[model samples]
Target chain A: MATEEAAGGLAFHPMDQFLVRPLFGGTEIHWYTPTNVTLWMGLTVLAIVFVLVIGSRGRAIVPSRMQSVAELTFGMVHKMLEDITGKDGLKYFPYVMTLFCFIVFANFLGLLPTAFATTSHIAVTAVLAVMVFLGVTILGFVKNGAHFLGLFWVSSAPLALRPVLAVIEIISYFVRPVSHSIRLAGNVMAGHAVIKVFAGFAALAAIAPVSILAITAMYGLEVLVALIQAYVFTILTCVYLKDALHPGH
Target chain B: MATTTQEAAGHAADAANAMLPGTDAHGSAVGMPQLVFETFPNQIFWLLVTLVVIYFVLSRIALPRIGGVLADRAGKISNDIATAEELKLKAKEAEASYLRALADAKAEAGRIIAAARAEIQADLDAATARADAEIAAKTAESEVRINEIRAGALEAVNVVARDTAAEIVAAFGARADAGAIEAAVAARVKG
Candidate 1:
């Protein structure tokens, strides 16, 4: 495979698209610097506004196509929150819904040729996951107080093994944020990278058709992955929030 | 071996530097930029902003509108169902009343027919009674006339017989009184 890659001559820089360069062609990246991430993230926000705000502006009793789409997304996320966390968990619905919409929009927008996938970066996903983690933790303490720690303790287990189980449980509990962020970022990054690799292979005349076919198939799968990842992320947030609301076994 | 490991570490550093933007060292740009520490703050800041914006838009505007439409549709459906039920009940009552009125009309028509038949029968009975009375009167008058005619025929016969008896006595040349002959004829006819 290494020889084949070398023989292919074209060094496919699949990860270069993820580079955070300044939008105006500068090299240095600062906290406030306008970069490709800023542009795509801004575009994601605009796309969300277009769908949620302008799409449902008519508020038609019988929805138009755009209105239906907006309503479908709203209802789907609403139902997910309600089902996973119950009605009590609905207080955090806006946060979870925002996460879902942003992730979904960023993912789908990334599918556009040459568009940046903001959610594909660990920085963005980590921020989202950490915020969820912090919010749920704070809410747990605020709502449940000292009893929230009972989530790590397994009273159902034997007394001798309870402490051992607690340690493992605590580790897993803390690992939630890491897994949450990486799952989304990894899935998005992998799909985009795979497509890029296939596209790079398409430059070869002998394997161009096969590479294009693979790209098309991967793109289709990536579309589903993009939506599902958003769903999985939101549901996980709901689960964490549920734990905070009722932090027992 | 130590020198070789140090050389590898220097090569790795060179590769990392080469991957960084604006570095002169050359390497394949295969590194994931997501690990780049310099861009973390920027991505996090924008993510926070975007999430906050999306949350506000959804909670304040989008969700409410969608909820309103769903609620309005549900309400409309329930109201239409209620109205349909009311109308169905009204239609049932109308049908019942219609049947009741039809029954009443039929009963009234039967009464009218019966009354008309009774009245016609009464008229027929009266006319028959009047015609019988007229026929009985005519029969009585005819009976009286028949008796009178029979009495007149009997008187004529008696007169003829008395006259014939007187003529025969005169022709025979016998000494007989007129009063006595008359008496004899009367006696014979009476007997």
Candidate 2:
């Protein structure tokens, strides 16, 4: 906030854009109240529908550009799902693909100027991670019953150290959802914040060019990070799903 | 040293206000709203709705269409390859049968050639044998005619010699009888 008033007496509120104000101009945000977050999230869904549903409506064998993009995204995620979880994992392909498409769309949409990054918040990511964690855990129990507990037991370790290892394993296991959620939120937040700080520096004539340059560089990196983060999140989900289906050493 | 001291003072101020809920040097409701926790429920609710809608769209519509195109391509390629393999097998069988027929034809041709040569050889042998028989018969007949001519000439010569002998006796005027002259001429010729 000091940086806001540091240059030319103009207050540059970089974090101000992240504020969740009601779209209807009300001060308070109720459960049913629509906010900028809702607008952007809705836009994200519309964007997905446009590209995936309406774009490939013709379903030409030799696809148009939009259809090609849709099929490419579909095949990429399909192959990733198949590769990580094998054929049986394809049963949950739609759910995993939904998570991937949503996160990626939200991330890329956030990259637009003055756009709100819903994925940058812990609340959004925590829900996704917890859902995956709970789903996999329940699946493990259903598929393997009592053997699902074997994931925590260090059967390969020495008998003396097995208990110690189990405790550590259990702690890490519980930490999975926390780490998963925080990793995505932290990376997205850091990139956007860095860009905002650079943009704030752009108010000064002396450093305006340098700040713009830095913002451009950071934007490029953020673009790559957005895609990579989405991929990482999906693949990790697949790995956890694999463990649930087959919970051995 | 002066800059470091001022930085320390700034850090102290930040630490003091950091504990206060949603208030910092940026004033109330001015910090990162992502940390505010007020907007979370709304964001989470929308995210859920969006994700559920996307899942249905993909599973119900988009995925099945793309899957159909892929399966159709795979089916076409495999069918074409299978047809090619079948044609290749047929071509190999035809070539094999052609080679078999050629070999059979060659053997039949050789048999025909050998049979023709043998027949020609037999005809040549019969012709030579017939010509040899004809020459031998002609030579035997010629030898018999020569012997007959020689006997005829020898008889003529004996009669001439007896007539001349009687004429010479008659010129000497001896007056010899026919039976006595003949007996004398025969005894002289015999001697």
TM-score of each predicted structure versus truth: 0.82, 0.75
lDDT of 2 by residue, A116-230 (tens): 9989888889999999999999999999999999999989999999899999999998999999999999899889888987997887899999999999999999999999999
Summarize candidate 1's per-residue lDDT along A1-249 as a digit string, tens digits.
211244657557677677776788645555677888889988998999999889988878788899899889988988988987789998777778789899999999999989889999998998899989999999999999999999999989999999999999999999999999999999999999899889888888999999999999999999999999999999899899889998877
What share of the reference contacts is kept in model 2? Answer: 0.49
Top lDDT: which candidate number?
Answer: 1
Q: After superposition, how far is residue B39 of candidate 2 from its true place, in Å?
A: 2.1
lDDT comparing candidate 1 with the true structure? 0.83
Q: How does residue B29 of candidate 1 score in lDDT?
A: 43
Residue by residue across B1-191, what tens digits does model 2's lDDT show?
A: 34433443454356644322243545433557776655566677777887788888888987787777666667877988999999999999999999999999999999999999999989988888888888778777777777777776655655665566667778887766777766666676668
What range of 10 consecutive residues in model 2 chain B has the weakest lDDT sum? B16-25
Q: Which ten residues in a row have the lowest lDDT in candidate 2 chain A?
A: A1-10
DockQ of each: 0.34, 0.22
